[model samples]
Target: MGKNVNFTLLTMLYLFIYIVASPNSTIDKNALLAFKAQITSNPNKILAKNWSQETPFCNWIWIGITCGKRHQRVRGLNLANMGLGGIIAKEIDGLSFLRSLIISENSFYGFFPDEMGNLSQLQEIEM
Candidate 1:
């Protein structure tokens, strides 16, 4: 019985460590904030205001954002019908996990980046 109790205690401690040390716990917070800043600087309200770092962007609940089933990286960005007008930043290519990009019904006038094809997960690219 004592051995079992010790195992349980060790398991709990390991879980606590994992929770506190995981990158997802903090990386997402900072990344989401940067994304919010980018959207705010954009001309249109393509990104809704509710997606700040203070708000946990759960994959199932996030608006205009989608994550991979496993890695949960930013996999899709749906900015259609939002009237956003500008070139997609070259920095956006940094979202390497991106798969779907929808920018229809808006006015973004700029040359499409050739690097966009580098997104290996990309399946749909709607302009």
Candidate 2:
């Protein structure tokens, strides 16, 4: 009985650790959605067709998104010259692991969100 109890305890501990360490993909997804919400124009309909909750964000690489291999966290967003027009959302800072952001040649207006300063891992940004 004691051995069984010990085995159960160990199993529970491992499950707990897994749950705690697992990546929270929802945060990244919501941030991307927020960015999409602000888009006033998508001439290509790229985002309008995609970027939905039905699909995982990591699967969006074909649309100029990149994710970390280990944690599946968003690492890069390259939407250069897609003719996208919108205001930058402050929620973009929620992408804590974002390293690169490129939106050059687009028609985005409004001041840059101060929340972007929270991206400690960001390494590049192209307006």
lDDT of each: 0.66, 0.88
**In TM-score terms, which candidate is top?**
2
The TM-score between candidate 1 and the true structure equals: 0.63
lDDT of 1: 0.66
Q: Model 1, 10-44: lDDT tens per residue?
A: 99998977786456535544554544554433454
Candidate 2, residues 6-69: lDDT per residue as tens digits?
9999999988766863546777888999999999999999998877778877865348789998
Clashing pairs in 1: none
- Would you list the clashing residue pairs of candidate 2? none
Q: Per model, how many backbone clashes are there?
A: 0, 0
Error of 1 at 110 (Å): 0.7
Whole-model lDDT for model 2 versus the true structure?
Answer: 0.88
